[model samples]
Structure formats: structure tokens, C-alpha cells
Target: MTNPTNLTPSAFTGARRVATALAIGVLTGLAQAGALEVLVLDKEGKPVPDAVVIVVPSGLGVAKNPPPMAAVVNQEKMQFLPPVSVVALGAKVRFSNNDAWDHHVRLTAPGTAVSANPASAEGMSLRLEGKTAGKPAYSAVLTMDKPGATGAVLLGCFIHGSMSGHVYVADSPWTVKTEANGIAVLEDVPEGSATAKVWHAAQVVDKTPQTLVVGSTPAKLTLQLDVVPKRRRG
Candidate 1:
């Protein structure tokens, strides 16, 4: 369920992205790739599910796709499956009501795009001047004004107040949602050093980037997070 407070559009005001597609492609094509295993735990060291983990190389750029990576959120039995979704910025999302009755999906969040043109990928410039700085790109939400779009929106059934779900729009291609076991595996990482980031709807921070190094063998990382859940709304 999505709490009405704590997470709003104004959050991610300091976030930015650039040349995201090329960066993901290059990282995908790395010759010597390794796996990055992530373990997420709460401040109490309890497993936290649905947390997002993203890795950005030290000298690469980040960008979001137009449709938010074709992510889908389904409503069945008056509940949302995969309760939380993670998508890249500018990605497109789909909402479906599988319940017998009708349900309305709404997403409320502040969204902005730094790309020269939100719709034109060619028009999207990194301002990198052909430099691979490997700086971590920040993320902000994007409104779903078009059909089948999803970003930072509060999805709910106007009729069923108990129904709630959320979608996260991120900037990096290396992002994944933590499973129930608090585990996430990032594969094909080039053997080198990179920056690791954790993002969730409940927790916000000024800066908390960790260093990750991928080598011939797989690496394991345990991340501690606070379970500051927002109160349920009526």
C-alpha cells in the first residue's frame, strides 16, 4: 500500500539524468562482466522487500526511456500485484483492473525531465560533451498524461479506499526491486568500480552513494535501510 505522505513530487528536486541509453548499451556489451549481488536489510537487519537498487559506472551517463520501459501494474482481487514497480524515467506504464468491478488508477507526484526534448531521443543530449564521468544520475517522477503511461502516480480505486499501489520512475538501467528475501542480483557488470544507490518511496536522503567493484567473481553486498513506512490512508 502507498501512504499519502512522505513521498511527493517535490522530492527528487535535485535529481538529473543524461545520455542514459548509450550508457546501458555499453555496459551491456562489456567484455569482462561480473555479477553484483545485493542484500537489503532494515535498520534492525530485517529483510526489506521491494527496495530499489541501482548501479552506475563512474564515467557513464544516465537517461530514461520514453515509456518507462513498458512496465505493467495489474489490479486483481482488489489488490495490486508486485505491489511496487520500478521503471526508468520517460518509460511507458500500463494499468489494468482485473477485479470484477471497475477501478481507477491514479498517480500523484512531481515529475520533470532534463532531456532537451522529452519525446525525442535524438534531441536528448547528455551535455557530457562526450565525457564518461560515471556520475550517478538522480531521478524525478514523470506524470502519465498520455495513455498507458506510468511514473510517480498514486494508484488507487476511487471506490475502494483500501486499494493502493505505486510505481517508481528511475533514471538508471541497472535498477531492480528487492525480492521478498531481500535479495537482488545485478548481472553483466563490467569488472571495475561503480556507484551503488538505493531508492525507495518511504526514505529520502541528501546523499548516500556507495562504491561497488565488480571483478571476475561475483560480489555480495548487504545494505541497511530504515523501514519508515507511511501511514495508511482512508
Candidate 2:
């Protein structure tokens, strides 16, 4: 009985509001019984942490939004908000700096590394021009033109070497980033064997497909992902 779109935060921008509205409509239409709730679990069975879970319907029932003119990745406190991002193919992303200093944004071609790769080719890099405190956020737009493309783009600040984030590009709009509670909900899944993929940084914990069956009543599903500690190298 919870309104999915109602969960949006007050800080949501115009585009986010639009996206949330569309997502709610799509989810409402796909509500049904017999839905499978999946848990993306590690080998130990605890909830996998910080993983993005995406549900792609087998049928062509999902609506597609026209690629937006631009997309934005905000910079604040020498860090990227939403450290992990997933956007549709051909969409553009704008890098916005909220901090007083400048930020250098970079990206990698989709599907380059498994997130743990030591060396990966840099996709592209750009700097965000600074803005006054009261001015609207300044953004650098990056377009994703290639279809069937997926990858994690690393973002960093020139002033802060330790700052980094990931930009995940997918072919569809079913992508959902995990929350602090470690839950990524994909609503309006069609009735059939649909595949839901979960990715953390560059590591793919759940590439295996999950089956979703839709009916007349609302369906609930749960997925679990494992968070493995990064191995240190000399």
C-alpha cells in the first residue's frame, strides 16, 4: 500500500521528480501477485552491501524515455554524491561541482573492468567550473552514445587524490542503486522470467538472472549482495 514515488526526498530536482513520476506509473501498471522476491546473498548468506539491482522485463512492456539533453553528477565535499550511478544508453551526464574548489571528472568505457582491475583505460576527463555559493550548480555534460554499452567511470578531484566514485551506464532504464539499508527496488516487473543484475563499483555480484511473475496484486521481491573487502596489493 506504500506509494513508491512517495519515497522521493525533498531535495529531488525537477528531472528527478519527472523520473520518479514515470517510475511510479510504470510500477503501478506492473503490480501483480506471484512476484518473486530475490535476495542477492554472498557465499555466507548475509545481505550484500552497496550493490545496484536492476530488473529488466522480458517483454517490451516497459516505456522508454527519450534521452535527456544532459545528465549531471554532483561534486560536494571533494566527493561525488550517489557514488554509484546507472543511466540508460545514449543519455548524457553532467558533472556539477558543489564545493568551493574545482573537481576533475573522468569516465571509463562501459564494461571495462570488474571494478577490481588495477589498470583500466580512462574513458574521458573534464573539469567542472566553479560557481558562487548562491548560483545554480555548475555542470559538465557527458553524452553516452554507444548502444549495448556498460561501464564504470571513475570520478576524482585534482585537489584530493583519495576522492573517487563510479558512473555505471546500462542499456535500459530498469537500473536501481542500492540504499544505505542495502535495498534496490525495481517496480513494475512484467510477468515472466526477467533478469535482475546487481553491480557494485566494478564488481558484479549478481549477474545471474532472476525470475519475476506479475499478477493482479502487488508483488514484493528481495535481493541480497555480498560486500567483499578490497585486497591490498604491493
Q: What TM-score does model 2 achieve against the real structure?
A: 0.64
Clashes of each: 20, 22
Q: For residues 1-234, could you state the per-residue lDDT of candidate 1 as single tens digits? A: 877565565553323223465566676553466778888777677777777787775533332221145666666667766578876555556565555455655444433222223363221211111112353222223333333332334455556788777666655567778887888787766667888877665665422878978788998888777665543332
**True-structure RMSD for candidate 1:** 21.0
For each of the candidates, the C-alpha root-mean-square deviation to the true structure, in angstroms, is: 21.0, 13.1
What is the alpha-carbon RMSD of candidate 2 to the true structure?
Answer: 13.1
User: TM-score winner among the candidates?
Assistant: 2
Candidate 2 per-residue C-alpha lDDT over 38-98 given as tens digits, one digit per residue, 9 for 90 to 100: 4445445545544666666665455333223356678887777767666666667777888
The Cα local distance difference test for each model comes to 0.58, 0.59
Alpha carbon lDDT at 96, candidate 1:
55
